[model samples]
Target: MRFSWLLLLPLLAACNSNPSAERGEPGFGAADPESPADATALPAPDTASTKAVSAVSDTLRTVRQKHNFSNPKGPADLFKLVYRGPSILDGTGEFTITNPTGEVIFREMLTEPDLEAALVYEMKNPTATRAERETYVLRRIDRFFVPSQFHTPAIDPNAAFPTGLETLERATWDDLQHRPDAIGFDYLKGKEDRQRIAWSPLTKQVVRVQ
Candidate 1:
């Protein structure tokens, strides 16, 4: 875990930090699951999803999916995702990571806008339909936490790091140069919003690199 801090530091510079849309913070700015703009063009569900629903009344869209990062130091399936809404096109996503024993160490929220903003590449045509957009977002969630998504020593040691790190982040960044095995969770909120999270054994918790 000590190495994890080192790994995530470099990611701070690489990812976007929206003052109003941070993951751990409340709202995630996802006011309405189905935006009026999107719903106007989208049709009603032909059938409800078979996935088990939580206590909430809103549609439990993307069923909680457990992802095993399988670190080199050996923790299997550390991350889990629980989402609610009709679908990601208009959903709220809960991102959490736990230790081997299933104790949650980190948690955050992402709304449709937060996740959808990054899909501009897929929806290049401003007029793409709701169905087409949903297909793309769903695929993003499916492949979110695979091994290929995690980075070993998330920051390339040889690459120049960002210059604005705070005291603790700077220390972690400096230490990461030697920890080739340090693993960092990596994903994107949108095209410019790449997120990389790492664990810190010293802090006994996970810290957002930025």
Candidate 2:
């Protein structure tokens, strides 16, 4: 199904406007009430995961220098940078400048060409699962310029595995799903509704469920 990217603006506005309203809810900023006490326990990264993370960090550093994309010195200096060719990734791209504190000051949907290319590349990889492909694309872009640890959601034992690319593509709503001010948006389909949903990433509580 085709998604209307235009709907993203209002969704973002809603989250940015009231991120603290649901801070106490499960998966918002509080621990999931239904999860086991050890659910948040994570083991040390394996050799492969460690190597992959290091590779991405190195690539991002090179891309930042090659493009002259210096980190923002302050919040007032943050803004979008657009790319028209294959310098950083295999295609065109755009990303926000990260603040000196390393927080992303802007948010946008995944419309960048580099992300699109990554998706295409992942689709062609015979050994990659759908989740792996989507994760690859998101990490490669790092649109939010967030810390690697907050790039994705924690394992939610109650949440079903995402079905495919479309579902994964809309999974940003759950990004940083355990921080008090975490905010993001995504496309979701409920029993009687199908539209983009904006929510507090810290709690996963809906601010605008439509």
Candidate 3:
């Protein structure tokens, strides 16, 4: 009688093939919720603002910034980061980034408070009309994907990471700082809170640069 181990091959293979065995790795946390719950359309922030528009799952606006934000050698406007749904402040919104072939690589809820920075200009003039304030957000969104808003070196040595990023985040920030061709998205979150987001070749996903 001979003892053989070949009988265990199929059992071992079956365990390896089980889908449940797969698990997601840990990633750095973000300040904002990556996915925002859909909220009912609220009255415009200002009483003098335009009448609230009814909420519907419709395309509000789409902006394709003419820049190679997704890839280093890619042509201009290779990626279209669309601003969908109604204006961030008026209704629940979403920001989705699509590749050249129209495949969405990144998707995130666009919260209203993020665009509140646009209201600062109107605050300057106590009598600023509602239309003028609305225009400010429109212009801010239009320029959201402009070339000027995309920085080559995502991370700045002098820039402060007020959020106190973790080890994984610091690694990603350092990684972007070294890549000269890597482009990052720069936008205002609060009054003057500038946020930097970029597609990390290493992470194979979009990450907030410190």
Candidate 4:
């Protein structure tokens, strides 16, 4: 599933739809619930501040390898590593990366929230031959994997895991753009063709592509 960069001018330049564009379907940027027990719980944190976002990312990175994708400990336990205290809802999430030697490499804060219970992520090894930055996202829907009642297999509706590499790459870029806290990240997943592009905040050029 090779993606051609020459194509995809439409999606790259498409206009972002309003929150109501989906006819009341909650937009990714909508406000998150105030409590984790809220019915319409969102994955965001309590405060979308820079410090809070960084804390969230750092936590995720610390637990990325320690966590058992096959079995989770608990939401409170998971959040504790990242929040340094109680976790709060704020409509923003973080992405973190770790090297094979268990050293922190890179981290980014996004609009994804409260995924400790249902999401799993792993950064592609930076030393790979192609040197492409890729991350894996998943959602856990199946319970019983963890001792706590909150156990479930993290599922990624937008993720294309079993599919080829192209879908997987597109999902990653899409996730970044969908973030409500993305003030510096630039993402581009071309439309009508298998193309993906991501840019940094400063240079405004393609940093990753597929």
* Highest-scoring model, lDDT: 1
The candidate that wins on TM-score is 1
- Candidate 2 collision pairs: 27-203, 28-202, 28-203, 29-202
**Per-prediction TM-score to the true structure, in the order listed:** 0.62, 0.19, 0.58, 0.20
What is the lDDT of every predicted structure here?
Answer: 0.65, 0.39, 0.62, 0.32
The CA root-mean-square deviation of candidate 3, after full C-alpha superposition on the true structure, stands at 20.8
Once model 4 is optimally superposed onto the true structure by TM-score, how far is the C-alpha of residue 174 displaced, in angstroms? Answer: 22
lDDT head-to-head 3 vs 4, winner: 3
lDDT of 4 by residue, 98-170 (tens): 3234444344443323333222223244342211211211122112122342212222235444344433354
Worst ten in a row by lDDT for model 4: 133-142
**In candidate 1, how many Å is residue 55 off?**
3.2
User: TM-score order of candidates, best first?
Assistant: 1, 3, 4, 2
Q: What is the total number of backbone clashes in candidate 2?
A: 4
lDDT of 1 by residue, 1-210 (tens): 999999998899667565555542446664354668757767877666567666476645443444443344675645766667864567878887767787888888877676666667756676778787777666666666766777777567785656654434666665654667766788788568776666665455665453
Residue-level lDDT tens digits of model 2 in 1-210: 136677687897887753444664544456565577645575655787453433333333212311111211222324343434323343334544444455654443334343544354336655766566456544654442323212122333245435443534334434423332332233212122223223334343333322
- Comparing 2 and 3 on TM-score, the stronger one: 3
Least accurate 10 contiguous residues by lDDT in model 3: 24-33
Alpha-carbon runs more than 4 Å astray in model 3: 1-57, 75-89, 156-163, 166-168
TM-score of 3: 0.58
Off by over 4 Å in 2: 1-79, 86-91, 100-176, 185-210
